[model samples]
Structure formats: C-alpha cells, structure tokens
Target: MLNIQSGSTEFWRAWNHLLRPVSSRVETPRVKLSRRWKVLAVAAAAVLGVGGLPTAGAASAAGASPVHIRFSTGGATPPNEMEAAIFSPELQKKGILKGYDKDYTLSILTASKGTPQTLSLLAADQIDIGTLGFSTIALGQAKHAIKGGFSVVVAQFVDAHPGYGANAYMVLKNSGISGPADLKGKVIGTNQLGSASDIVLRAWLVNHKLDPRKDVQFVESGYATQQAALNSGRVALGTFVQPFEAMEQASGKAKILFTTAEATGETAAIAVVARNNFLKEHPKAVKSFLADWVAGLQWLAKPENRTEAIAIMSRITGTPTNVLGLVYGVKGKDYYRDLKGCPSAKALQNGIDAMVKVGDLKTRVDVSKLIDASYLPYPC
Candidate 1:
C-alpha cells in the first residue's frame, strides 16, 4: 500500500510537470494544487530522512554525518552580549554543538571555571574544545594533559581601570603609592598560582626593576576576598580586573594601580585550546563551528550593532551597561582581529619567556605551534 501511494505521488508529480505550460505561466487551481502537494511530499520525506538535506557550506564538507562538538569557554559568566545572542546561537544551529542543561554540550570547555577545573575536564575527556588562558594552555601542554586545536577569543591590551580588565593591579587610595615602584615592600594579591594576574604581576614587577621574589609579596586572593582584604588592611595592594577595582574605589577600599598594558607596553592575553586526540578525530566539525563563530563576531562588531552588543555583554557578564559600553572596545580596532591573536604570538611567547626567566616555568616551552590560527576566517 505504501509503495503504491509513493508510486502514485511520483506519477502525479511527473504528469504535473508535463502538463505545465512553458512561456505562458499560469497559476490555475490544478497547477497550484500540484505545486502545493509536491512541497508537502518533500517536507514529509525530509522528516523521515532528515539526513538527506544539503548541509550548509561547512557541514556539507562532512557530508550527512552528524558531527558532535563538545565546546567550552572560560570566565565565571557566560559569553558577553555579542556572544550569547549571535555567537553561541549560530554555532548551536549546526547541531554539531548543542545546549544541554543550559550549558553547551559541544565538545568545547572553557577556563572560566578556573584553571584546575579546565585541565581536569579535558584530562577526563569531558571537554574537547575550550577557551584557555595562554599560561594555562602552556602549562597543561608541559604536563602533557592537553594540546591546541584552535584559537578562539584573544586578549586585548587595554589600560582601563584594574578589575575591569583581566590583568590589573590595585592599591589603596591612601597608600601614598604613585607607580609600580611604590609597591616595593608592599603586599600585592591575585587569585592563585598560575593565574593571568599572577603572571602579569610578576612581569610588571620585573619591568619596574623589582624582584617578584623579594621586592613584593604575592598574596593569594579572590574578587570578594581581595576587596575585603584591601578594606580590612590585609594587603596594601592587589592585581585584578575592573569593576572590582572600580568597586573598590567606589567603596573607598582600593584604586586602580596599574593595567597590564601599562606594564608590558603591549597586549598580552590567552586563547582557546583542544585536546590532541579530540582535534584529530573531529577536525571538520571544529572548522565548521569556528567559521560560523567568527561570522557572529564580525556581525556584532559592526558599528550599528555596538549598542546592542554592549547591552548583551552587560546582560551576560552582569556588568552594568554603561560600564560595559565604556570598557568593551571596538572589535577589529580595539579587540584582536576575530580569532586572531588578541594576545599576539610575539607577546605570548614574550610573556612565557618572562615567566621562564623569573623561574615560573622549569623549561622554556615553544608556543608557536600551540596557536592554531587555521580555524579563524582567512585575513583575520
């Protein structure tokens, strides 16, 4: 019976095409019915053999195979404005990456959950793709825990207030501190060992001719803890990003001491990484996801989209819209070219070398190969 029905459908379709007049198109009832029914039939078939549809450009490369991408990112909060609305949504549509439990299940993981968590997730194969801090990625590679797949978000060097930017140094307003040199014999704080703030602070200290080991004391602290520490006089100074620095000043606890850009004279930051085996196994899906992800960034970077983009980033990061707008810079001009080095290779290698020189790393690791720029759109 099913075969007979199918045969009849095909016969009618063919007959409809034959009877259709050429050079004299007419939307007669019969022609309309035929076209409508044909569309219905195709739709029905698509539901049954959904895999038969032509995948979009990127997906087309892999044929009809359903590629599963486990994606991750860093930062305590979800992607800022442009990312949630434009970036993540477009990528998830590929079905290669999907949201499970409000969290993306794409083989991607990020360092936002903290360095240790990121490493553990990758080591257990729970996450395949992740946005990682450059320092974290290098350290993980050294320990043989994970490797690079593609570079995602890059760090922009901004001299905005500390705590707003990721690598900021803070000091109390009344500490009588004027510059990096004033911090000598004073206490500074960061989240933990191997953090961006930790590494950048050391670099900053060395840049000012102070020894990180002796001239300054490194105190382990958190956002809330750092604010509290500064308030209670636990530490004379600290290093962190904005809002925290802004908040400290707002609350009359601390002031923006220095931004990483001031110390390094260049933008130094982090990137996304993939586990070795994961990258090898699912290279196609990786490329597709990135192509669309970069598209979203480009779209959001447009001048017309700036207002909405800032609102979105503010919503996600919980940073005030006013503050977010001021802090988040223009895309191509302020931020790194999409998927290109936010923290350029030269800067990252320099940072790593600085770390090694300060005895932060046992061996100087080569990071050039670690940055997979192929995932980004050409001319990035």
Candidate 2:
C-alpha cells in the first residue's frame, strides 16, 4: 500500500528511495551505439531542442525496447489512486491496459507536496509525467520554472462538477463554528500551502470577505492527520478529500462547513501533465499510454466491475473496502473523470483566474495554450 503521510520523514525517505533507478529494472538494452557517439547525439539533441530523434515507440517498433515513463501522483484517491490500474497486471491480463508492457512501462511516484514537488521533479528531469493542479500550472508557466515547460496532456480529475463529489472543509459538529465568519482568529489545517485544496480554501475565505493571511492561522497537516487535529482542537477547520472525508463523515464527529465547488464552480482540480521535451520526443508512446488510460477508466466504469474496482482501490490505498465504497466510482459521490482522458481547458482557466483574484498567483496564464489535447484518446 502507498503511504501518504507526507509529514513523516520516514515517508520522504521511502519515497526518495523509490525514485532511484535500479540497473536491473531496465527492460531492454540500448541500441548498438558507441558511448562517445551516444553522448554526442544526446548533447546535440539537447542543444538543438529537436524532437525527430528515435523515440521509445520507434525503438520498440524496431524490436529494441519500450520506453520507461515515471509518473507522479499526489495520494491514494481518485483519480490519483485509480491511475494504478494502468500498471496492474490483472488489468493487463484482462486486456484493459493493452499497452502496459508493449509501448511503455510505468513507474508511479508519490509526490506528497502535490504539484509543486511534481513541478520540481519535472525541472530536474526526474519524472516524465506529473498530476498537477491548475494553480501550479499557472505558477510554472508564469515563472518558466521547468525546462522545456510542460503541457496538460490529460485530465486526472475534475472537482465539484454537477452530480459529483467535491472536497470538503469540516469542523467538529459541536464546535459552534457555523460558517466562514466564525473562523476568525482560528487555526485551519491544510495539506500544503499552495496545494489545490489550499488554493480553494483561500479563495473561499477571500470570497467571504475574510483575509486568510490575517484573519486565520494556517497549519500544515496531512489529510490523514487532519481529523485528529480538528478533534483535538488543534485546528478549527480541516480540509478533506476522500476517503478521509468519507471516513470523517462516517464517524459523525465532524460537519461540513463548505465545499470547493461552492467557492469555485467546476474546476479542474488536477490534470496529467508531461514535460514538453517528453511529449515531443515520445508522442507515440504518450498516445499509447493515454489509450490504455482511457481503456482502464472504461473498464472501471462497468457496472459489473464495481466491486472489483473498489477492491483494487482498497488494496492500493490501504483504505477499507467499505470506506472506499462510500464514494469510489459512485455517481454524485466521487470526483468526475473524463472517460476520453481529455481535460477541461475552461475549468483550468477559471481556476487560474481565481487564484490571481485571490492573490494566490502573481501573474495570469493562458491555460489553453499550455494544454495539448491532440494526444488524448478522443477529441476534447
């Protein structure tokens, strides 16, 4: 099971260990090229910013080797957790993920800091694909923080769409904090300062005429620990995503104060992004991966697969089946995912604009230009 307790040093250590490459894990040998020529070729490609070089797909077609793709996820939740299905041998056996070991191999890395950490990894060339939030996309584009930049290739999940579940802000049922007005001079817990949830929280607060910087104190806490922090009076409000939200609501100890949808209507909370160089160099492999991704989603959406889908998520996230069943794949109780793997440019643009209005972003970004929908399984 994936451990998402990001506040723990041990978790970071384990995560970093997983990021290191192991020679034995290489799926195939490189093409027969001298070391000096290979180094020169790489240097020339880097200097020229060219994309016509042999890619994983081209090499694999020539019976060489499949491409290795390192993808990042924030935690064990939809659609982050659901992405594990793309790597499941069971799914591959059933032909749900038809391209798993053919066109590309996948390594799903956990980035607890969410988009910021993912962006850093992209800049460092440590990750090939990352699930990033709208605010992070804006920040990266505006600052040009990543080499070759990145493009939104597919949708991870959409928050607060009609008939879909939205992330919640919860407080103890009897805490007497009825609304945002009562949060003044109180501490609120967040997963991270610039995370999607945190951005929404800040926007909500600003919309309510409260200054998040001066009216309330912010404390960093993982979603796993927010319930305890709230119950112990360490924080008056705790931001929650599923299955933590479902678990907390089931406990009957907390009540929902507001939801992210109420603050920003129908936002693209997260999307799958890839570095520009990777997209340009491995277009065929990226498209094949996306095809399998859409296929996986289709397989999970089957009514007959509900039980097994829940079980798969349960096993991956270490959450009980019953807890995950509360919202996993349930219409109106889970985040919305595009079956075709196309992300909503309009929603992302709105989210970025909201961040600027809330002072969370210094500059605005044209999200449409940063999105590459041509690689999706179908038209956007």
Candidate 3:
C-alpha cells in the first residue's frame, strides 16, 4: 500500500515546470568487453540459436484470431488500471487479442529482478508481452539478454522533480522534517537495490553532498512493505510515486518532502515490451496491440475521462480518489506519452551514470544499445 496526499503548493508547481529533461552526454559505466569480444559474441549468438532467432511460425498460425497472450505488468495501480482500461477494450474492438475480459491472462510481475528472476522471461519464452522501465530494458539488452522489442509511451509532463526525481520522498508530519537537507542521518526506504527510484534518489542526495550509503541508510521494501515500514516508525522517509504519495498525505500518515517533478521538468516512468519471439511470429498481432494501446493512451488523456480513470485506478490499487486526483494533476501532459516528455535520453543516461558511479553496474553501458526508436507509435 502507498500513501497519498492532497494538493500541492504553487512553489511545487513552478518547480516542476523549471526542471525539464535535457540531453548532455556523460560517461556511463560499461560492460568490459573488447570490441573483438563484443563482435564475436554477437556473431556466435547469431549462429547459436540466440540472436536473430525466429519465433515458432506454426504455433502463431494456429491461433490467429484473438491470439491468447499473457501480458505482464508491474505493481503500481494507477498505471496498471489506466493501461488496462485503455488497452483491453481497444484491443478487443480492433479485433486484435483478448486480455481484459478473458482472452489472455494478464500477470502482474513483481519488480524484483535477480539471478533467476528477470524481465527476459520473454527470451526464455515464458510471458509473451510485458512492461518495464526503459532503463531496466536497456540494462537487459546490454547484458545480451531479454530478446524483446519495445513500444514507447511518451510521458510529457512530470509534476514532481526531474532526473529521476519523479519519485516522492515523504516524511511523517509529526517527524518535524520539511526539506531535503533535513533528511541527513535519517533512515529512508526505496523499493530495492538497482531500482530506478533508488538510483535517482541517491543522485539527488549526492548533488546535495549527502552520502546516501552513509548519511542516510537505505532499506529495501516492496510496494506493500514500504507503507508498513513508514508507519512502524522504522523509517524516517519513504519513497513512492503519484497516488500513493497523495493518498498517504491525505490520510495524515505522511507529509510531502519533495518529488522528482520538482527536480526535473520531464520524466517517463513506464513502457510496454513485446517478446522477440512473439513479435517476430505474430507481427500483425503486435502491431494491433500497439495501435489499440495508443488509442487507450489517447483516451486516458482526455479531461472528461480523468476522474473516471482515477477512480478505476483507485479501485484497482486501493488508493483514495482525492489522492489519485492530486497525483494525476501533477503528472500533467506526460501521463499519456512516452519517454520524450518524461524519461529523456539525458535523464536515462544520468541514471546509468549514477548507477555506475555507485558501483551497481559492473561496467560502462552504452545507453544507445538499450533504446529502439524504430517502434515509436507515430510516423507509421
């Protein structure tokens, strides 16, 4: 469960508008592979039934009409319901595939990724479609894993701070902490190590001259555990996105400390990914999915649907309407688009660089290898 809050002040509003995403190249940690090793790997993988491998044509042809699929998503509710409401109907109406009503099994994949559990469940031929942060997808690609293609949803406006600042840092109102600097020496909570929120938050701390690892200890908490950690007085601050932050504040359980919108003007937090095998075999199905999904995104952006979208999201996530509303307002235009408006290349590269500086990434990663702009929903 996440905490949500009411409306924000004008300063918070103005701050969000100022910190937009920008493009500036910075040296990021890369995987240590000589050019020869890299070429050899690509070549070997190409010949060894890995890279450029095609999907099973017979299976795809067997299930042409409303193909059965298992689309995986994350835990956050607003994005979940918003995506569901938009995509499910559009997919069915467009004669694509079945998911929302019953044609497919939509699995909610937890954010935990490690030794065995990874987003590459697609490469392993487990799930057919899923969603992941662009940064996560990029990391997977650089590792020579996760054979998938992506469809970007550009998030145009981020009401919170920028440069990974899209997440909120909250404190209990009674804790007497009001600003970022006040968090010195306090215990803070993030989803986990290697999480986007963790990386960005650490960068914010570093910019402020605070040693995230030393000055403020970070604890790993899942979506459900984060709220519990904060309520138990075990954590002075907890990080979360949108509706959760608003809901917590509205309930008087927490206070707004700061948000990524307040730091960076642009931010992108979500993306839809299709497995390479499925995408290759069912090209038409994949295209249909993107078309419907784009329609869904457009519908969700409408002012008339805003309230209903928020309610649907609240119902799914168990967040309050007021809190959801606040979160929605802050997100602005980017709520409907892809990374161009939200998680720009500059911001993502910053994340890569931050992770490298913290020694989380083993080697330098070329940011370009992770993104595939060839799949943008427009210019079709």
Candidate RMSDs in order = 18.0, 8.3, 14.6
Q: Rank the candidates by lDDT, best first.
A: 2, 1, 3
RMSD of 3: 14.6
Local accuracy of candidate 3 as per-residue lDDT tens digits, 1-380: 11112012332232222222222112333335555545444432222223344222323456534444455454354552244555443334654443333322232333233212336554555456655553465566556565544433233222233322256777787898877778888889886666656666776777677887688887877654566788788899887665556556666888767665443324344445565656666555555555555556565666887787667666666777766676663444124344222235554555566666665677766654444444344642
TM-score of 2: 0.84
Each candidate structure's TM-score, on Cα atoms with residue i matched to residue i, is 0.66, 0.84, 0.68
- Best of the candidates, TM-score: 2
Instruction: Indicate whether candidate 2 or candidate 3 has the larger lDDT.
Output: 2
Superposition TM-score, candidate 1 onto the true structure: 0.66
lDDT of every predicted structure (CA atoms): 0.53, 0.77, 0.52
lDDT tens digits, residue span 1-380, model 2:
12223434544433333333545225444345555544444433322222344322344457665776667776445534467755566587787777777878766666666678877777777667888878888888888988988899888778898899988999999999998899999999998888778889999999999998899999988777788898899999999888889889888999999998888888887788889988887887899889988888888878899888878777766778898888887888888888888889987887888898788787788899988988877897
* Candidate 1 local lDDT, 52-125, one digit each (tens): 43211223245535454444444433222122534544334544233221222232222333455556556655
Model 2 has an lDDT value of 0.77
| Candidate achieving higher TM-score, 2 or 3 | 2
Q: Which ten residues in a row have the lowest lDDT in candidate 2?
A: 43-52
Instruction: State the number of backbone clashes in model 3.
Output: 48
Query: With candidate 2 superimposed using the best TM-score fit, by how many Å does residue 115's alpha carbon deviate from the native?
Result: 1.8
Error of 3 at 234 (Å): 1.6
Worst 10 residues of 3 by lDDT: 1-10
Cα distance off (Å), candidate 1, residue 234: 3.5
